[model samples]
Target chain A: MLGYTITQWLFGILSFLAIMFALMVVFTRNPVNSVLYLVLTFFCIAGHYLLLNAQFLAVVHIVVYAGAIMVLFLFIIMLMNLNADTEPRKHIVTRVIAGVVGGVLLFVVVGALKGAEQLQIVQGGASQIGLVKNLGKVLFSEFLFPFEIASILLLAALVGAIMIGKRDTNINLK
Target chain B: MTAFIIYKAIMCAAVFLLSLGVAAYATLWERKFAAFLQDRKGPSRAGPGGIFQPLADGVKMFMKEEIIPNVSNRSLFIIGPCLFMVTAVMTSVVIPWAKPMMVGGHMYDLQITDINIGTIYLLGVVSIGVYGIMIGGWASNNKFALLGAVRASSQMISYEIAMGIALIALIISSGGSLSLKDIIEGQDKGFANIVWQPLGFLIFFICALAETNRAPFDLPECETELVGGYHTEYSSMKLGLFLFAEYINMFISSAIMAGFYFGGYNFPFSSELYASLGLQEGDWLISLIGFGAYFTKIVLFICLFMWVRWTLPRFRYDQLMNLGWKTLLPLSLFNLALTVVVEYFRGNIHF
Candidate 1:
């Protein structure tokens, strides 16, 4: 029954790809390659959102993460001229410790998720509720204050970053 | 169900091929239009008034030697143009090309798919188009190409803000729905949205020009300065792909502009004429006229693109940035506020 529907198939494939890309994002030696892998992971998650019928979230996730944020990351990585040759190899003990810690983290996550298969997932979660009109109504009516606060927080962060980055160097001689 | 799927498959193929053909012919038209503006004959030797020029040009692109620089990243260099072409083609998916077609007592929607978040999908696809230029420029490992890529991504990213804001005003006017079909139908019930969204249209047109990298905002690939810009190192079909993608973008942008602002195929007097002819809706005759009307809108906008290209000088890069950030951004925000206030007064908004 779980394998019969297209949605279940898509979720399986996308989740597999997402996890694979997430691993690749960390394991890739080249920063640009890592960024590209992260982009793929973002796209996979966006596909999962679309599978859940959250089209708005899917598009916004792509627009914000893959389109903008990852592009910025790639820009910085490219500007820094990073490549395999430039990468500093980590110490063997450090790598071993990281492997152990990562293994433990995976174990805990897998343990936590072991029972998830037993839980019944809805085939569709009220598609109309996920549409833009109802979402907008819900956001504005119930979550209006939180949305406004989030905007103000982002605005403050943007201004602070600008202020921190701006310099007043006036000592150039031609 | 299979028939329905087959119909959609046909519509997809038709839209894809239509975009490709339109982009090819648009190149020929651009040259011819330029000739008209400058009082010269342009490529008449190929066919009647150079009608076969695009075909000839395409053959040449295929026949030319494909060159990849030794220093360049080989796979990415190959992938760049392909991605550019793919993104260019993808934007057309959200644009509804025609009204429903009736065949064998079944109504088949003439569009490929009418996704709910059509405008957002379009904007997302367009925003990602920057990657094609960025990767192409970067993979070339050429300084000029890298600079061109940087300029492309920055320009597209900046202009997209204004473009999004301008479209927000349209969305407000359309009463918060992002479906292009609904918006076009809404305009059909009234005057074309251009009447009410004139400022939005102005900002939108300017931003569209910027987004497509057309003059006077064509700094990304401006030939004189960058020597072919991002595609400087590319040759043969790769270069053709890069260049062809621009015309495709132009065609799609025109279709978008027509769909959003000019009421798409909702030509003024067509319905009256159809009523006078005693033909019901979804008749083949009406569909033909409506299809012609939609293409007319697209062709007119395409001509406007050519007109501006031939007329206006390219802007300096700084001037381009300044216009995008200082002028268009603030103007679009003002348009947004104005629209909100007006809609409030018109009682289109509750609370």
Candidate 2:
């Protein structure tokens, strides 16, 4: 049998990639670069989704987060015409403090995960129940209210985007 | 055990190399296809119907003088295309090229990885892909690039809803499994889900086109108006990477559509075909042949993408938004409702 060591190694590499990219996203000086790095970070997170047996969630994460939202972020960054010089420079002390805070947060999260050793990691591989059909049934039945609310939230966001994006002259006419 | 490890390693390398090679040649194929449609000879001089064209193009891109625009954000400019290409290539991991094979007393699926959430993983990767264009355009510090990025982002976001809704309809019909393998297996019984979910297929196809930023939906890099759109300030291999990612995306998108709706590696009368060929059940060779069939379908879809690119005109920004929100979105929602009603009446509703 192929040993679990290979899988563990693969997971280790992917997790490291994800964490590094996430850090890069914040640390990058250019906002546009930061956005790109964030996209990388999201892709790595999707990799973790694959490792977790959540294929549908992984694809949806890419579609929604990387494909759609990141585009919006990029659009905003570009529209703002931000440059390296335009970006506010943080003082060295501020940067150090931020780094320390981030390090502490990371340590806490890792420590919590380690402390939960008795917690079983469910091997929820693809089954008949996890299909889109099952998900839809749950969404439309047990979670219908929340699903509807989410739709409403999306609608509100859409309308707000339209209103905010409208030309000043058009708004004045209204 | 060492042999098995070696074989798996070789397979991984092969798939990775093959994808990159195919992505390179896809550019050549697109050019040739576009030229054929336009009634012109496409790159005939670059070695026997332009087989060496991709290599030549690669060399040219590599050798080109790299330019960093004076006012541009250098770091982001570099990051954009790298992010784009990485996301484009990463989507292939979960794709089942063939059924699992027994080698050295171990059964292994031909896919690189068999993640349960394979389809959603693809969507997530694609969503992140937009950042490449956005960041590239933003870093350029050009008004035109900024405009292009804005148009692209909004367009992608609007169309994504329609796409998601269509997929939801398919999921309801298919009984909730998001793994591509399971989705393929679900269709193995008889008719493909596309037969039952025709409207859903249509909605998904159109959205797929929009998602890939193909012709009519390719407002992000609309050359005539936005001066090459998001990549206007890009130069050298960095620009080439962005363009390369687009084509790879096209290939990947087509592969996905084929997998989800076209029955993947399963062909009509495939079982009979296997029997006629004297292939035993679970034969690795037969499965590989099935993989070839699936790939052929994917290639056809890719060709269709190029065909559409040559056929259609770019959509106006307002028209694009309208199509996404007013038309495709409503149509997909209607289709979803229809699917639910039909499935409920048929007693196919598992819940």
Candidate 3:
């Protein structure tokens, strides 16, 4: 047997699960099922974050992706009443394009992994970086500019959403 | 390591049993409390003052017939209630029941696990809780159930934003530690968070009501409109699980409110009493007294929940959404700013 601590074994299992569920998200015929599978994939990713001792990241991942975003996706699908019977079939040309796009994405990922291998892998030591206090200090001090920029970007997106959602007063008056 | 694992296992079992037991009694109490409000006796036949009512109810639920619609998705349909119950039980793990107790030479925390991001963990678990109602309602393949599920998910999502903001305000005033233990200790040293963050507490309280699907905000299971709502197609223990999870959620949220705002497990004159008794810190007896105080606070909160449930009428769906987004959200933001201002002036927080 290969030498592996419980943590390593758990990491391997979670990685496998993440990939499997990601595949399930694509393969599932029903839209609701697809969304639920994606949620499982998110949970697996969150598990990976926990294994890294990024406790804040892990919980936030669950809260945002698995909890909020996926629920919205499921909500939309449920509202639409989409099912396997109602799923529109793709043309052969469209399927071919999708396949090609997926292949290119996989290639890019593999290339990234190859590059990542050259970088030093910090393994097997508990780091305080994941704790909220350290994370807040880092974000506030060193990464202050990027963090504020991100907040501004989010505010802009919020304004855009509200504008899109608003009705035309002129049309309503008429 | 072995001893630690064994201790943790025991803690898990204890917490699991405690939640379930509390949830069971909560059901009986809800009925009896409702009876008290309406000026009638409730379930008096089971035992003296209906003490065995929950037990009887449990037996009835277990003995009843369970049905799964032929058209429904079997797996998701079955998984729904189990998921609901699991998440309900999972929340109690992070709650510090009392001060750490000294047993033999070791200090053992009453909490199951004291993760650093305890508050966010609760939020995450609560956010995931909507899935149980959603899946159950959808998997029923019935129109009423589907409508219920839709209402549930939307309501939970809307209220959660305000709830998180309210929590952020409280966390700011209570020294920015996400751990419940630290929050409680901060209260022990000074005033409970409620004194400082009353607005935040009110917002959090309202949001908790909405989050738990308690009445006045229980649109998800509104019977007059959508007959039986989310559990329309459920039968026997499957339905029981959904109801049970609701009570457990109420209990856990009560405990959280106690910890976050009400100085959990800390009573006035506690130190003086301990000193007079010749008991040192971390004494088991001291922890037990603190637990009794904490339990009293939680029970009071639970009764308050019941009181509101009986008194107030449910809001219209539009009204609920408007209150959550238009009212609570802005109020929570204002509270956050107010808390920040106060903390800075007090020199507790540095810009």
Candidate 4:
């Protein structure tokens, strides 16, 4: 019981930290600072995954979001080299509306979670069975078609990203 | 009982302190190694053989004035090194230092944590390590730093795909087990996985070296071009952290390489040797011996890392990109195909 409470306390603190960092990511005016905070936010999410016994997911989360995606965002921000002077200021009314919408979204999420009372909560050990090996088996066997489709989607996204990033050139259109 | 927890805590503390101490000394070693390579004696006045050089260097770094440029992003500049150190150290948790032992009617493993997805977790954590360099370079507010960060990020991304594909080949060859423990166990009985997947091992080793930003792929910190690369603006302990984190990462990657490809703590005829020694099942001493074997392997890999650093030359940026994308990627794919075919012929395909 004591162990459970300790784990819960840690989880709560981590979650709070994650949410705070995420808010900071949005609120920060500096794009570079915002991306850094987003990395922190992703770290907090990874912590949550750890708490949930999804070690693989936690690591993947860090690798993809904090490592790759955030680095790319930093690259774009640096490439543009926009400073505070170049940033457009948000009006007071717009800020207030944004705050209100953020609040409503948070409330709705919390309310929906609260309403899901009948969900069966499995303990850590029981859920540990579906670890990397089992997950791979399911991913390859049961969801092979969907997984292939997902790969195709990722390829499309990659091509799209490259196309958008390419410089405009004086060439004949197809 | 409580003593076991204390023992574990002490062990963890020892490994942490030892790694840091080693990282500090690695600077001195690098200097000496480089000097020797150039046919000159390195610093020898600090202490006997300049053994105290790292201490002197540490003090000097701490005393140095930390210059924060007015235009620099001060907060991120501060946070960057801290992030690097944290990510570097975190990957050590899942590494099994030794085998499990029976203590007080319960089994205890020598690792801090033994998650089922140990290898993937490592992959994931290493992937995030690039952010530390990116953040530092960007926060410096210098053109050189920016260029370094851009190069570092793209290089990391390009190399990561090949690294992941190499790992996929290993995973396929190993019958889809992602747990480092299982992989090590599978490689027991004097039949290491490297024998089966030599190409995969080679690919993974090269990628590992590149991932840790060691020499030959140390373009991010290349002095000739980018003037200390991403860390040009850093000073004092912040700079120390970045440098120290690199060594720490080197050590971790070496340990990981040993664990995955070198059969970890297992040795040929280990079971027979244990039997001859009259070591019964659940013997803590046997586990200790096993752990020692693993530690020795890790140390050897570290020495190899240092040797390679001294021997290799840095790769050109275009060459690095081409090697990662054109060469390593296609090779890994071919290896993956080979693994699949072998498994299929053996009637051992999991599907």
Give stretches of model 4 more than 4 Å off: A1-4, A90-130, A162-174, B1-8, B102-106, B281-288
Please, what are the lDDT tens digits per residue for candidate 1 over residues B1-351?
A: 899888888989999999999999999999999999999988898988788999999999999998899988888889889999999999998787777778999887778888989999999998889888988998998888887888888999999999999999998877778988888878777689888799999999999999998989888666776776878899999999989999999999999999999989788876788899998877888777878999999999999999999999988888988999999999999999999998889788788
Q: Write the per-residue lDDT of candidate 3 for residues B197-266, one digit (tens) a residue.
A: 9999999999999999998998766777758688999999999999889999999999999999999998
DockQ, structure candidate 3: 0.89
**Could you give the interface RMSD of each candidate, to one decimal?**
0.6, 2.9, 0.5, 1.6
The weakest ten consecutive residues by lDDT in model 3 chain B span B219-228
Please write out the lDDT profile of model 2 over residues B1-351, one tens digit for every residue.
Answer: 887677768777877787778789999999999889889999988899989999999999999999989877777778878977887888887777776676656677777777666766666666666666676777787888877766776776777788888987887788667688888878777888899899999888898888778886887666767677878888899989988888787877787789888888888988888889998756788878888988899899988888888898988888988899999999999999999999898787755
Worst 10 residues of 3 chain A by lDDT: A164-173
lDDT of 4 by residue, A39-99 (tens): 8888888887777777677778877787777777878887998777789888999989999
Residue pairs in steric clash, candidate 3?
none
Against the true structure, candidate 1 reaches a TM-score of 0.96
How many pairs of residues collide in each model? 0, 29, 0, 0
Please give the range of 10 consecutive residues that has the lowest summed lDDT in model 2 chain B.
B121-130
Residue A150 in candidate 3, Cα distance off native in Å: 1.0
Candidate 2 whole-model C-alpha lDDT, 0 to 1:
0.80
Docking class of 1: high
DockQ of every predicted complex: 0.81, 0.52, 0.89, 0.70
Better of 2 and 3 by DockQ: 3
Which candidate ranks first by lDDT, i.e. highest? 3
Candidate 3: stretches off by over 4 Å = A92-97, A104-116, A168-174
Best by DockQ: 3
Clashing pairs in 4: none
